[model samples]
Target: MIIKRYRVKSMNEAITRIKYELGREAVIISQRKVRKKGFLGFFSKKILEVTAAVNDPEEKNKYENSSTDSVENFKKVVNDKIRNQKRQSDFNYAQSVNLRSENNEALLKEVHQMKNMLDDMSKKSYDSLGKSKLELKLENMDINKKVIENIMNKVKEIQQDVEEKKKLKMVIGNMIKVEDKVLENAVVLVGPTGVGKTTTIAKIAGKMSLIEKKKVGLITIDTYRIGAVEQLRTYADIMNIPFKVVLNIKDMEKAIDSMKNCDIILIDTTGRSSKNKMQLSELRAFIDRINTKNIHLVISCTTKNRDIDTIVNGYKELNYNNVIITKLDETSTYGSILNIIDAAGKPVSFVTTGQNVPEDIEVMNSQKLTELVLGEDIIC
Candidate 1:
């Protein structure tokens, strides 16, 4: 490997230098702040020192050449498989020529169903053209001006008068995305205190275990609160799910190991004050030990937009890409959802509508969220 170090003013500058000198394939090894020596090192300015590495020229060249060849080969193999399947299908049709009449009936039925769906969508699009009510409702709900404008501009292009509520919901839903499926075996929930992280964990664990039939395990790292551990333990006992408590990195690792057979392990982290950098950093250390991609930052929808921005900014260092907005029932206006989504640029995974565990929590869907924001009753 070719390794080199560069000193730069900022992370962006360091990255640019690494890419320029070591190529885009280079990997960042480590980075730290270092002070330059000036007059016996008494007075100096701090700069970022970044260490990066790249593979040897021969290995890099060979890997690059093989990548193109591999892609071409993969495409050829896929095409050949497709052609073989087509030929096999043709042979089967010739052998079963009498079945063609029944197959045509089935195909015609499917085509009619598809046409009906398309016509319904087209009518809905035409009904959604007059969005005056939507604009007024969004304004009353206190959604951000720019976000409202963007949604309006996009919706105005489709001149349809269908169910305005459903149309509006679709438009709003398009702005958010959710991870309804469990991709990672272990998931961690992090957020400020009183954001309902513990309860949310229980809700998710219950759903996965009861509804999805996944073997669920619960782990809590919220040792700071006096009753936090007991609370989660009680829930675990009621749900008949295995539970563990971790106070440090070693405990966390052991807890995770104990739940290795679990289909999904939900972790509850101690809430930290966003302003407290040391606490957030400490929490990050415990999370780093787990090495999971499913870290969700929980926030309350009732929080003011300014505080929401602060919380989102403070948690940025934790690198949380998914957000769960809780306490939706407590708030009248949900403009904060859009505000936080826009400001943080993170997709909301779930929204907790009430205090009811499992039942109250719903995977965020654009249409439902739009209805909630517009002060319309959500049927579900």
Candidate 2:
């Protein structure tokens, strides 16, 4: 018999190669799991060591004539291969260790440089006795300085021996507000143009209809944007929910009446430029027909702090009750979330992390939001 061994990723791979090299009559003699021979033996990838053998008439005759000699020679050859593999592995391990040592030295140097830069910044920040290191950190996070002062002042009131990060989280949790209520009977989403109002509607509608099992209805008065109505309609169709298009106040009233049987109705209005008084007034007229108490002003997190103030103030006339912050994934700074809450005095109803429908939107959670704002972790 002729025998061979294979070190492969899986039994299937070994079997395929063995069959090709040792013929269809080949049979597995032994198999075991082994890691690559190296200093990082436990960390190395594990693979299958399969020994396969096949019947060979010529080899069988030679083996019978001098079976002992043949076996000894085979063992010698196997030992030689193993010894060479060990030598090669040792050489590779030495080279890897040397390279890693050099890399570690460079890494330590970079870390020292970073530490020096941070030390300089800390010294400069502390030049003002009014600001703590944590306060400076918050300012770097783009939180309004006034807001940071307010939060820090509040944090100083607590007398517990708590960690600074935890203290900040506690103070922020109490300071920021979020609306945790379920969707009202009639809800409307409005925002300035290009703030992802339509997509936010779909995300909310999807969660309500598919996840909450609510009899959800979708109505769009967003004819100003091309494909806006179709985009929402597609989401409605997929969810197998009722959908309608309203062109005027009369159309809006009729659409609401038709979906009166639905557990909740989600309305989508045309995005208006905050600068356009005429557009905002027109949107107000349409939503007035539904008389929704849950009108959420949608805004993008990527909006400049000043622009967010503009959008919020411009839409103030619409009497929106809550805020929906979208595109949280697109920006590095989260101060806008706290900024809007403080600026508008309206609790955030939801926050959208991406463009995905349903999956990317989260109903505002106070503790989680605080952690994210503090750079504890990326929720997305």
Candidate 3:
């Protein structure tokens, strides 16, 4: 049974509400006249109040069935929503997995391409694994790449069983030329500026004058720089040897004639810039005027391989037969020594180790210099 109350304007209205909502089987149990009042009883209205009751078992069963259907429908909707969300989540995961796989494949492809490119480059550059290793070792010693290439070519011609180091030594022995002769009659030192020619000449002069007691005389054509004449003159004064500063090429012959009484004459020329063709031409003219076979092109060991080539080529017109390496203590790399020797096609006559007079300079030891270039020993 169910009971409900209704407040309406009349009993008819209440009966109509009860019949529509509770069905016609509902019976009115009580009725009363009532008033709906607002605040302070100012807005009040008279209404009819009715109490209704129903006890239909069929209607009760219908209500229970409708509630069960609504609950089942809600559960179905929630389950569908959950299934849809799960499908979307699975799709996203699969997409991420596929993307990673594709990315990995792309990375692998790139790696293989790079490896193939490197392999191709190696095949084109190196003849064999042994040659590659040898080339790398030479490069570490700072030998010029072109020079090393030439060496490798020679190595390729030799028997493989000869052993790499021995083969390298043999090859270097053939390529490198050295003159054990220190000083010759009327020798001239010429090269680019700042290669220590003045000091080198001083050292050589000191050696000949003090140690060898050969009655050495010094002459200079390097009067371009400030105090050039005075510096050599000072050294000459210290050794009490004859010194001459030739202001012009015509004066060179007179200067040489003045030093004719000495056992050996060491001539120092101006350090010319390799780029200055005019200066180099003038130098060539000056050198051509001198009559001597012991013309040595003095170069610094600290000079770069390219610059050494430039300096050597720049002074090629001078017809220098022997080469002198200076500032041996200033650098560790000795490949330039070999490079300059090979490029000039001349023997290395002397190498100056330091600024010390007479002590730091020595005749070129081909075997030891080759070893230094091969990284077997350090230059001290």
Residue 357 CA displacement from its true place in model 1, Å = 2.2
lDDT by residue (tens digit), candidate 3, 297-323: 999988888898888988888889989
Which candidate order results from sorting by lDDT in descending order?
2, 3, 1
Better of 1 and 3 by TM-score: 3
Model 2 lDDT per residue over 1-380, tens place: 78899999999999999999998889999999999887997799898999999879787677675676767777887788777887888778777887888888898899999899878667545645656678777876778776888888888888999876777899999877888868868899999877888888888888888888889999998888799889989999998999999888888888889999998988888888888899899888887888878899999878887887788899998999999988999877788788777767788988999988888988868988887788876645
lDDT of 3: 0.85
- Those runs of model 2 whose alpha carbons end farther than 4 Å from true positions after fitting are 1-131, 159-163
Best candidate, TM-score: 3
lDDT over C-alpha atoms for residue 100 of model 3: 74
Question: Lowest lDDT 10-mer window, candidate 2?
Answer: 123-132
- Give residue 135's error in model 2 in angstroms: 2.8
Candidate 1 residue spans exceeding 4 A from truth: 1-136, 149-171, 378-380
Please count the clashing residue pairs in each candidate, in the order shown: 10, 0, 0
lDDT of each: 0.83, 0.85, 0.85
Off by over 4 Å in 3: 1-131
